[model samples]
Target: SQQGEEDPQALSIQEGENATMNCSYKTSINNLQWYRQNSGRGLVHLILIRSNEREKHSGRLRVTLDTSKKSSSLLITASRAADTASYFCATDAGAGNQFYFGTGTSLTVIP
Candidate 1:
């Protein structure tokens, strides 16, 4: 169980359905980040929630962090076909500006 390593390596959902993914990490962190990457493009920042924060939201994206459980979850509501992409979670340990990334979740929103 390394830092920022999470589950559900892949996910598939229909358009208009919601999608959820989880991320877990070890040790203390300053903030957790979620990113989305298209097939061959770079990652796009989704959201970042601080350690002191329980949850945050941006548009159709909702993020929750529980330091007690050392885990975080991302929820995308009313998903769309254009939302199809691989999502990765990142954690900034706040130590020397280092960040750890999760394996990533491949999401396919079928029309």
Candidate 2:
């Protein structure tokens, strides 16, 4: 499968702390995207890094990609209780508009 799997199905951290999640896929991909979903809400796009790129950052979020290992990581620094959400890694397998999402890592940032 071209789908990726993320480690640590769930994580809990205090506010102002850092959270990290890792994902590993089975095939080459065009791009990988991270999304955040709050309870009962649609997903919000956090970041998207292409295969040729190694790392990218936005605000308190940092993402790293290693194509050779078909793996990726996302780091969220100084997280807040508002950051509590389910995070998913999605990969575009060079196909149409389809993407395969990881099982997801549920993060809880306690205040």
Tell me the lDDT of candidate 1: 0.91
Candidate 2: segments with Cα more than 4 A from true spot: none
Q: Compared with the true structure, what per-residue lDDT tens digits does model 1 show for residues 1-111?
A: 345876788899999999999999988888999999999999899899999999999999999999999999999999999999999999987572778898998999999
* lDDT per residue (tens digit) for residues 22-109 in model 2: 9999889999999989989999999999999999999999999999999999999999999999999999986747899998899999
CA lDDT of every candidate = 0.91, 0.94
Q: Candidate 2, 46: how far from true, in Å?
A: 0.4
lDDT of 2 at 5: 90
